[model samples]
Target: MILVTGATGQLGTAVLDNLLQHTPAQQVAALVRDEAKAATWQAQGVSIRVGHYGDPASLDRAMQGIEKVLLISGGGEDDALQQHYHVIDAAKKAGVRCLAYTSRALKDPSSLANHLMVRHFQTEEYLQASGLPHIIFRNILYMDTLPLFTGPTVLETGISLPGGQGRVAYALRSEMGEAIAKVLLAGTCDNRIYHFTGAEAYSFTDVAAALTELSGRQVAYTDVENEVLAGRMRERGVPEVAIERTIGFMTDIKHGQEDIVSSDLATALGRQPASLVEGVKLLYKL
Candidate 1:
């Protein structure tokens, strides 16, 4: 059976949904920390296995009789690396034939310029050394996060961020999830690394223009200093780690870390990925 970790999460749930379209529900198993959150999966005849990255025993149990595994990277900075190690170890013990991971798309993942990139690189290195057949999806920034960065209403406040003229190849999370499902269903280990990115890159300036055209309102892109934005996020009670990570992402973009475009995502789905404007319109109902 194909087992998916973090099955209740947005991307994981989307992946499972797409996988179900290609294969039988009985051929799928969902590894979720909370069985309560997986009621829908269970109702659809999916095997619900309880597991957490922090608990190696639970992970081992969750991989029982599973041939292939999709390991969605865990959240948070603290202990996330260790948690991934735990999962890798358990997967190794369980004799899983193939393992796929969602990782950051960086030219040199080993460069320690950003903490998030560093963690992903570390995990990638560890996974490579584990001797398990693996596939790595080096995913770009998710368009789903656009709503979060845009704040409550883009039409009213416009687009404001610390990134300056930095372009991101942002793909819809659901599309990327579909590509991942295709990979899992094909069960191919020949292609080790795949960059799942949008067909084009866009900056906040482009975002503003698109919003203006879509909403028929005068929207603008305001560039704020990193410190100023971080301070504002802090004043608004955003967590310390979140503020730092947000600022770090903007910094990475400014340095051109996220300016990448790839057509592999389209090739996997056998169709073009949704454009940014189309995704935004659907997201805001514009």
Candidate 2:
């Protein structure tokens, strides 16, 4: 069986949906924290396993006879590391033959935002030492944080923190999930570490232009310093920890740290990924 952790989430759901196209629904299982949230998946004939990163016992039960598990990185609190360890331990005990983990693109373990990737490395270590075949996909940044992105509440404030023109090889989260689904069902590619990325490169300036075209407005890019940006967010009531990390990572990327593009994602899936133009049309309903 193939098990997808965090199946109720956006990333996990994309994987589940794509996997259904490549494999039978009955052969798949959605490992979600809330069974109630998965009524549609259950009604569609896919097995629903109630589980959470915080609950090792539930993960154990969910992985009873599973051969492959996709450990989606859990988001929240200082305990994310501990909760991930619990899930990894359970997967080991269950004797799953293969495991795939969603991780960020961190070439340097000593980089500023490498803390998150470090945890993924820890999970990779557990999988390696446990004699379980594994695949670690160090993914590039998501394109969802584009210039046109806006929630109902945030749209009123207009665009914020429009950085001073830096290029990021931002891969679509859907493409990442599709690649994961492809690997899971292929039943090969064991003990392989892959770098998932998009085909083309783009800058925030390009993103702003696209947003102006899509939204048909006079939106423009605005650059600000790290400290001033953080202060503004703090004054607006954003959480301190989140604000700090957000600025840190953006600063890391802005200075040409995240400018490279790779073909690993295309090579793994045997096809090209969506370009920024394509991604925006789909995401922005344009």
Candidate 3:
């Protein structure tokens, strides 16, 4: 059976949805911390394995009877790196035939965004050393997060960020999940890395133009200074950690760190992923 960790999360849920379309529910298992949250999946014939990334014993139990595993990256947890290590170690011990990990599509190790991706780099290294057959997916920024970056009143306030002329190759999180599910179902590990990114890179100015066309509003782009954007976020009561992260992301963009583009996602899906304009429409419901 194939198992997916963080099955209740957005990307994990999307992967499960795609997986169920091509495979029987009985062939799939969900690794969740809370079984109660996965009651619907359990009712649908998916084996619900209760486990925590931080708990090796629980992971061991969850790994039972599972030939393949998808280790979804943890979110915002302080000990997420250690938790990933635990899961990798357990998967190794269980002798899983293949393991897949979701990592970031970052090219520059010295970028300010390294603060966010250092753990992913470490996890990738650890996974490589674990001697388990593995496929590493280096995913780019999610179009799903564009709304968070743009804010609710983006149409009214225009697009304002510290990201200068830098562009990002943003792909939909659900599409990435679909591609990942395809790889999982293909049952090939091959110890290869795939850079899951959109076909083209786009700047905030491009986003503003797309919003203007889609919304019929004259949306504009404003590249503010780093401190200026941080001050605005502070005024909005955004948390310090989040503000720091946002600044780091913008700084990385300014340095062209997120401009990498690749065709791996399209090759996996057998079709082109959504364009920036298309993604913006889906995100805004326009």
lDDT per model vs. reference: 0.88, 0.76, 0.93
Predicted structure with the largest TM-score when compared to the true one: 3
The number of the candidate with the highest lDDT is 3
Using lDDT as the yardstick, the better of models 1 and 2 is 1
Worst lDDT window (10 residues) for model 2?
Answer: 147-156
lDDT of 3 at 68: 95
Candidate 2 residue lDDT tens string, 28-134:
99898789999988998889999788988898899987888898988855788788778778888988888888877755556655255467666667667767678
Ten contiguous residues minimizing lDDT sum, candidate 3: 107-116
Better of 1 and 3 by lDDT: 3
Q: For residues 1-286, what per-residue lDDT tens digits would candidate 1 score against the true structure? A: 9999999999999999999999999999999988999998899999999979998889989989998989999898489999999988888899988988999886555442467667887888999999999999999989888878888777998878988998999899999999999988997886388899989999989888888889899999999898888887888899988888898888888778888888889999999898889988877778
lDDT of 2: 0.76
What is the C-alpha RMSD, rounded to one decimal, of candidate 3? 0.9
By TM-score rank, best first, the candidates go: 3, 1, 2
TM-score of each: 0.96, 0.89, 0.98
Model 3 lDDT tens row, 1-286 = 9999999999999999999999999999999988999998899899999989989999999999999999999977899999999999999999999999999887686555639678888899999999999999999989888899999999999989989999999999999999999999997789999999999999999999999999999999999998988998999999999999998888888888888999999999999999999999999999
Every candidate's CA RMSD:
1.3, 2.6, 0.9
